[model samples]
Target: MISSIFFYSTAFVLFLIGLFGVLTRKNIIKILVSLSITETAVNLFLVTVGYIKNGKAPILTNTIGSIGMNNLKFVDPLPQALVLTAIVIGLGTTALSLVIAIKLYKNYGTLNITKMGGKR
Candidate 1:
Protein backbone atom coordinates (compact mmCIF):
# COMPACT_ATOMS: atom_id res chain seq x y z
CA MET A 1 0.00 0.00 0.00
CA ILE A 2 1.02 3.62 -0.57
CA SER A 3 2.43 5.57 2.33
CA SER A 4 0.89 8.66 3.93
CA ILE A 5 3.94 10.67 2.87
CA PHE A 6 2.88 10.23 -0.75
CA PHE A 7 -0.55 11.60 -0.01
CA TYR A 8 0.94 14.48 1.97
CA SER A 9 3.35 15.41 -0.79
CA THR A 10 0.61 15.25 -3.40
CA ALA A 11 -1.60 17.51 -1.32
CA PHE A 12 1.26 19.95 -0.79
CA VAL A 13 1.98 20.13 -4.50
CA LEU A 14 -1.68 20.68 -5.30
CA PHE A 15 -1.88 23.47 -2.74
CA LEU A 16 1.22 25.15 -4.15
CA ILE A 17 -0.08 24.95 -7.68
CA GLY A 18 -3.42 26.35 -6.64
CA LEU A 19 -1.76 29.15 -4.72
CA PHE A 20 0.37 30.00 -7.74
CA GLY A 21 -2.69 30.07 -9.99
CA VAL A 22 -4.60 32.31 -7.61
CA LEU A 23 -1.65 34.69 -7.29
CA THR A 24 -0.68 34.87 -10.98
CA ARG A 25 -3.95 34.51 -12.89
CA LYS A 26 -5.83 37.62 -13.93
CA ASN A 27 -9.24 36.10 -14.71
CA ILE A 28 -11.89 35.92 -11.99
CA ILE A 29 -13.09 32.49 -13.04
CA LYS A 30 -9.60 31.06 -13.05
CA ILE A 31 -9.04 32.40 -9.55
CA LEU A 32 -12.22 30.71 -8.42
CA VAL A 33 -11.06 27.46 -9.95
CA SER A 34 -7.73 27.80 -8.17
CA LEU A 35 -9.54 28.42 -4.92
CA SER A 36 -11.48 25.20 -5.44
CA ILE A 37 -8.23 23.37 -6.10
CA THR A 38 -6.79 24.72 -2.88
CA GLU A 39 -9.90 23.64 -1.03
CA THR A 40 -9.56 20.14 -2.44
CA ALA A 41 -5.90 20.02 -1.44
CA VAL A 42 -6.80 20.99 2.10
CA ASN A 43 -9.45 18.28 2.21
CA LEU A 44 -6.94 15.73 0.97
CA PHE A 45 -4.43 16.79 3.57
CA LEU A 46 -7.01 16.49 6.33
CA VAL A 47 -7.92 12.99 5.24
CA THR A 48 -4.26 12.02 5.08
CA VAL A 49 -3.74 13.24 8.60
CA GLY A 50 -6.19 10.62 9.86
CA TYR A 51 -4.52 7.68 8.13
CA ILE A 52 -3.14 4.77 10.15
CA LYS A 53 -1.00 1.95 8.84
CA ASN A 54 -2.75 -1.42 8.94
CA GLY A 55 -5.71 0.21 10.61
CA LYS A 56 -9.19 -1.22 10.52
CA ALA A 57 -12.47 0.63 10.68
CA PRO A 58 -13.48 1.87 14.09
CA ILE A 59 -16.50 -0.39 14.07
CA LEU A 60 -16.26 -3.58 16.06
CA THR A 61 -17.13 -6.75 14.20
CA ASN A 62 -17.56 -10.40 15.05
CA THR A 63 -14.89 -11.29 12.54
CA ILE A 64 -12.27 -9.44 14.60
CA GLY A 65 -13.56 -11.16 17.71
CA SER A 66 -12.24 -10.63 21.25
CA ILE A 67 -9.77 -7.91 20.33
CA GLY A 68 -8.80 -5.81 23.30
CA MET A 69 -8.53 -2.02 23.20
CA ASN A 70 -4.75 -2.30 23.50
CA ASN A 71 -4.63 -4.35 20.30
CA LEU A 72 -7.10 -2.21 18.39
CA LYS A 73 -5.68 -0.24 15.48
CA PHE A 74 -8.65 1.76 14.32
CA VAL A 75 -8.05 4.73 12.07
CA ASP A 76 -9.31 8.08 13.26
CA PRO A 77 -12.77 9.03 12.06
CA LEU A 78 -12.90 12.64 13.21
CA PRO A 79 -10.75 14.01 10.43
CA GLN A 80 -12.80 12.12 7.83
CA ALA A 81 -16.02 13.56 9.21
CA LEU A 82 -14.54 17.06 9.29
CA VAL A 83 -13.39 16.71 5.68
CA LEU A 84 -16.92 15.71 4.64
CA THR A 85 -18.35 18.82 6.26
CA ALA A 86 -15.66 20.95 4.63
CA ILE A 87 -16.54 19.49 1.24
CA VAL A 88 -20.17 20.55 1.60
CA ILE A 89 -19.21 24.04 2.74
CA GLY A 90 -16.69 24.34 -0.07
CA LEU A 91 -19.32 23.36 -2.63
CA GLY A 92 -21.73 25.99 -1.34
CA THR A 93 -19.05 28.68 -1.33
CA THR A 94 -17.82 27.76 -4.80
CA ALA A 95 -21.37 27.99 -6.20
CA LEU A 96 -21.89 31.36 -4.51
CA SER A 97 -18.58 32.65 -5.87
CA LEU A 98 -19.41 31.46 -9.38
CA VAL A 99 -22.73 33.28 -9.23
CA ILE A 100 -20.90 36.41 -8.10
CA ALA A 101 -18.44 36.00 -10.96
CA ILE A 102 -21.32 35.80 -13.43
CA LYS A 103 -22.78 39.00 -12.04
CA LEU A 104 -19.42 40.70 -12.28
CA TYR A 105 -19.02 39.59 -15.87
CA LYS A 106 -22.46 40.89 -16.75
CA ASN A 107 -21.70 44.29 -15.26
CA TYR A 108 -18.20 44.64 -16.68
CA GLY A 109 -18.50 42.60 -19.89
CA THR A 110 -15.20 40.98 -18.99
CA LEU A 111 -13.81 38.39 -16.57
CA ASN A 112 -10.37 39.97 -16.27
CA ILE A 113 -9.91 41.39 -12.80
CA THR A 114 -7.50 44.17 -13.84
CA LYS A 115 -9.81 45.37 -16.63
CA MET A 116 -13.07 45.28 -14.62
CA GLY A 117 -12.60 48.66 -13.01
CA GLY A 118 -11.05 50.49 -15.99
CA LYS A 119 -7.53 52.06 -15.94
CA ARG A 120 -5.79 52.48 -12.60
Candidate 2:
Protein backbone atom coordinates (compact mmCIF):
# COMPACT_ATOMS: atom_id res chain seq x y z
CA MET A 1 0.00 0.00 0.00
CA ILE A 2 2.80 2.41 0.74
CA SER A 3 4.39 1.87 -2.65
CA SER A 4 1.08 2.34 -4.36
CA ILE A 5 0.47 5.55 -2.49
CA PHE A 6 3.87 6.89 -3.41
CA PHE A 7 3.43 6.02 -7.05
CA TYR A 8 0.02 7.64 -7.33
CA SER A 9 1.11 10.68 -5.37
CA THR A 10 4.02 11.25 -7.73
CA ALA A 11 1.70 10.88 -10.68
CA PHE A 12 -0.72 13.37 -9.17
CA VAL A 13 2.02 15.89 -8.54
CA LEU A 14 3.24 15.68 -12.11
CA PHE A 15 -0.27 16.17 -13.42
CA LEU A 16 -0.84 19.14 -11.13
CA ILE A 17 2.39 20.82 -12.18
CA GLY A 18 1.53 20.43 -15.82
CA LEU A 19 -1.94 21.80 -15.26
CA PHE A 20 -0.53 24.78 -13.45
CA GLY A 21 1.91 25.54 -16.25
CA VAL A 22 -0.73 25.25 -18.92
CA LEU A 23 -3.10 27.52 -17.06
CA THR A 24 -0.64 30.18 -15.86
CA ARG A 25 2.25 30.39 -18.32
CA LYS A 26 2.32 33.03 -21.01
CA ASN A 27 5.10 31.69 -23.21
CA ILE A 28 3.94 29.60 -26.16
CA ILE A 29 6.86 27.20 -25.90
CA LYS A 30 6.31 26.83 -22.18
CA ILE A 31 2.67 26.01 -22.81
CA LEU A 32 3.62 23.38 -25.36
CA VAL A 33 6.13 21.84 -22.96
CA SER A 34 3.53 21.78 -20.23
CA LEU A 35 1.05 20.08 -22.53
CA SER A 36 3.59 17.41 -23.32
CA ILE A 37 4.17 16.93 -19.61
CA THR A 38 0.46 16.52 -19.02
CA GLU A 39 0.33 13.85 -21.69
CA THR A 40 3.21 11.98 -20.13
CA ALA A 41 1.65 12.08 -16.67
CA VAL A 42 -1.63 10.76 -17.97
CA ASN A 43 0.10 7.95 -19.81
CA LEU A 44 2.09 7.03 -16.75
CA PHE A 45 -1.03 6.91 -14.62
CA LEU A 46 -2.81 4.71 -17.16
CA VAL A 47 0.09 2.28 -17.34
CA THR A 48 0.25 2.13 -13.58
CA VAL A 49 -3.34 1.04 -13.42
CA GLY A 50 -2.53 -2.24 -15.19
CA TYR A 51 0.35 -3.11 -12.93
CA ILE A 52 0.14 -6.41 -11.07
CA LYS A 53 2.38 -8.28 -8.66
CA ASN A 54 4.49 -10.90 -10.41
CA GLY A 55 2.96 -9.81 -13.65
CA LYS A 56 3.62 -11.91 -16.74
CA ALA A 57 3.45 -11.04 -20.39
CA PRO A 58 0.05 -11.45 -22.01
CA ILE A 59 0.67 -14.39 -24.31
CA LEU A 60 -2.08 -16.71 -25.49
CA THR A 61 0.20 -19.64 -26.14
CA ASN A 62 0.03 -22.62 -23.82
CA THR A 63 3.81 -22.96 -23.54
CA ILE A 64 4.23 -19.70 -21.61
CA GLY A 65 1.82 -20.49 -18.80
CA SER A 66 3.11 -24.05 -18.38
CA ILE A 67 6.07 -22.97 -16.31
CA GLY A 68 4.40 -20.06 -14.56
CA MET A 69 4.07 -20.04 -10.77
CA ASN A 70 0.65 -19.82 -9.12
CA ASN A 71 1.14 -16.17 -8.27
CA LEU A 72 1.84 -15.14 -11.85
CA LYS A 73 -0.78 -12.85 -13.32
CA PHE A 74 -1.11 -11.61 -16.87
CA VAL A 75 -0.88 -7.89 -17.43
CA ASP A 76 -4.16 -6.30 -18.28
CA PRO A 77 -4.34 -5.83 -22.05
CA LEU A 78 -6.61 -2.80 -21.79
CA PRO A 79 -3.92 -0.57 -20.38
CA GLN A 80 -1.45 -1.67 -23.08
CA ALA A 81 -3.92 -0.83 -25.79
CA LEU A 82 -4.67 2.56 -24.26
CA VAL A 83 -1.00 3.29 -23.77
CA LEU A 84 -0.25 2.49 -27.43
CA THR A 85 -2.95 4.79 -28.67
CA ALA A 86 -1.75 7.48 -26.30
CA ILE A 87 1.79 7.09 -27.66
CA VAL A 88 0.66 7.49 -31.26
CA ILE A 89 -1.55 10.45 -30.46
CA GLY A 90 1.14 11.99 -28.32
CA LEU A 91 3.59 11.77 -31.24
CA GLY A 92 1.12 13.42 -33.58
CA THR A 93 0.40 16.19 -31.11
CA THR A 94 4.10 16.79 -30.42
CA ALA A 95 4.86 17.01 -34.15
CA LEU A 96 2.00 19.38 -34.80
CA SER A 97 2.94 21.51 -31.80
CA LEU A 98 6.53 21.80 -33.03
CA VAL A 99 5.35 22.85 -36.47
CA ILE A 100 3.12 25.50 -34.94
CA ALA A 101 5.83 26.70 -32.63
CA ILE A 102 8.24 26.99 -35.56
CA LYS A 103 5.73 28.98 -37.55
CA LEU A 104 5.04 31.25 -34.59
CA TYR A 105 8.74 31.80 -33.98
CA LYS A 106 9.31 32.66 -37.60
CA ASN A 107 6.54 35.21 -37.54
CA TYR A 108 7.16 36.82 -34.16
CA GLY A 109 10.89 36.33 -33.60
CA THR A 110 10.19 35.21 -30.03
CA LEU A 111 8.33 32.48 -28.12
CA ASN A 112 6.37 34.84 -25.90
CA ILE A 113 2.66 34.87 -26.60
CA THR A 114 2.18 38.09 -24.63
CA LYS A 115 4.13 39.90 -27.34
CA MET A 116 2.38 38.19 -30.21
CA GLY A 117 1.00 41.47 -31.54
CA GLY A 118 4.56 42.63 -32.36
CA LYS A 119 7.28 44.38 -30.37
CA ARG A 120 6.61 47.69 -28.63
Q: Estimate each model's TM-score.
A: 0.89, 0.83
Candidate that would win on lDDT: 1
Residue-by-residue lDDT tens digits, candidate 1, 12-98: 999999999999999998999999999999999998899899999878888666776788898899999999999999999999999
Candidate 1, lDDT over the whole model: 0.92
Q: Which residue pairs in candidate 1 have backbone atoms (N, alpha carbon, C) closer than 3 angstroms, thus clashing?
A: none
Give per-residue lDDT, candidate 1, residue 86. 100
- For each candidate, the alpha-carbon lDDT, in order, equals 0.92, 0.83
